[model samples]
Target: MRKSSSLINIKEVLLSTRKVLNENAIIDSDLESDLLVAFALKITRAQLHANINSPISISEQKTIQNLVNRRIGHEPLAYILGVREFFGNLFRVNESVLIPRQETECLVESIINYLRHKSIESPKVLDVGCGSGVIGASILKYFPNIDLISIDISPNAAQIAYENILKITNNNNFHVLVGDLIESIKVQVDLIVANLPYIPTKRIPTLQKEIFLYEPKTALDGGTKGVEIISRLIEQSTKILKPDGAIFLEIDPDQKYILKNKIQHLFPKHKIKVLHDLSGQERVLSITIL
Candidate 1:
């Protein structure tokens, strides 16, 4: 990169980034600007805005240019930062695990409310396919009395999850295992939550560049129908969940019609509800054993 071209000022770089991000992009250009700028300067949002005109240094300029270029190409900001916020806590993220989405927090909130008011003896949680341990850790944050067990098929994912959950919680008596769902798990629990891979294989390539390019395909590619994992999960969940326990799954809305029916058939006596995200698309399915 030429010093002359690279010598473009911070203000100019922000303008260039904004221009490259088309109007139809999911994230607004302004938000992308803030994220890229803050990331490049290694400063907080407030600090970035406060020092926007402070004359970005040589390395800072190079870093800012590259990140902004990537952003303009539709890369996800979380991938660039290598961290994501979930349930009000920061967790390390990469292609190894699914980036925590806001919709999952709704599921977490529901569980927290249940444990907060209801009286139960030693509430236990099983986070099936616990990538990065994000969901389990969030629940652990509030319900310390609860025993938590998280399992993942990938050893790499298990390692990251273990490191993240080791000393972050008080009781810290949780279990992390590397194996397939339920079969590898031994204990019965009050609740089982999963943010399993639900995106249909054919639909993955059409996703935004950030998601398709940066995030791992295994964490997003739901089999041909998108519910292959969920189907297996529901079948095993009945055997693993306590008699009165429940299971929560994050899913794509388009699959609900069939998913709801399958849930009904899989656990005929259970109460099932299909939840919708902010966009009114059904995304979570919760079933409680009767």
Candidate 2:
């Protein structure tokens, strides 16, 4: 697309981008426009504003337009930007892994809070289905001394998670392995945390376009009943978790009762607590083996 004027500046480009995004019904068009423009220019949003009046090259404008087109085509903003912030830290992201969501932060918080009170030093943590390594990496950022093992079924996803964990924590206390759940795990751990795929297979198509169309299907589908993978994980936790160990999982609110029952059956002498996100939705499940 050709620019309306020969000397198009950053301000004009941002306005035109926002207008196009708004026309396409994209939410937060203003912020998205700023982010896209800044990303295209390899600059920060603050720098974009400071140089709003500066002229933009034709090549630069074309780059911004390309990104805007991708967004309008239903690609997620995080994928387009190649990064996402979680628990106050930014992690690299791509199509190989699921995009980090704010609600998952609740799981990280609960783990940190539990560890803070527990006397276990250098606790071993097992992160099941570690997409992009956000959960384990976030916890390690706060507790650098802890040993963490992150496992993912997809080799591509595992590689991305490995890179993200190393880049974010810069600590050698974690291992990212490619495996399905905890089947390959032999070492007992003090905690098992997972944000596994929980959306039922039938419900996958009903998700937003950015999710269903672009996000990895393996990262979203949770088998037929939606709790199949989680139930398996809970059952597997029985053999791998150490005594007085705990398990924290991010789950769909609707799956809590079913999962709770499964956990109760498998871990009869356990304490289970459901945590609510800011929106009051039951998001995380904490299971303490007593």
| Residue pairs of candidate 2 with colliding backbone atoms | none
- TM of each candidate vs. truth: 0.87, 0.97
Clashes of 1: 0
Q: Which candidate is the best by TM-score?
A: 2
Global fold similarity of model 2 (TM-score): 0.97
Clashes of each: 0, 0
lDDT of each: 0.78, 0.93
* Residue 123, model 2, lDDT: 96
lDDT of 2: 0.93
Local lDDT at 65 for model 2: 90
lDDT of 1 by residue, 128-238 (tens): 888888888888878787888988988888887887777456557788888887886667789998888888889999997778887878888889999898888878876
lDDT of 2 by residue, 1-290 (tens): 44456669999999999999999999999999999999999999999999888889889978999999999999999999999999988999999999999999888999999999999878999999998999999999899999999999999889988998998899999998999899999998999999999999999999999999999999999999899999999988899899899999999999999998898888889999999987899999999999
- The segments of candidate 1 whose C-alpha lies over 4 angstroms from its true place after superposition are 1-12, 22-26, 166-171
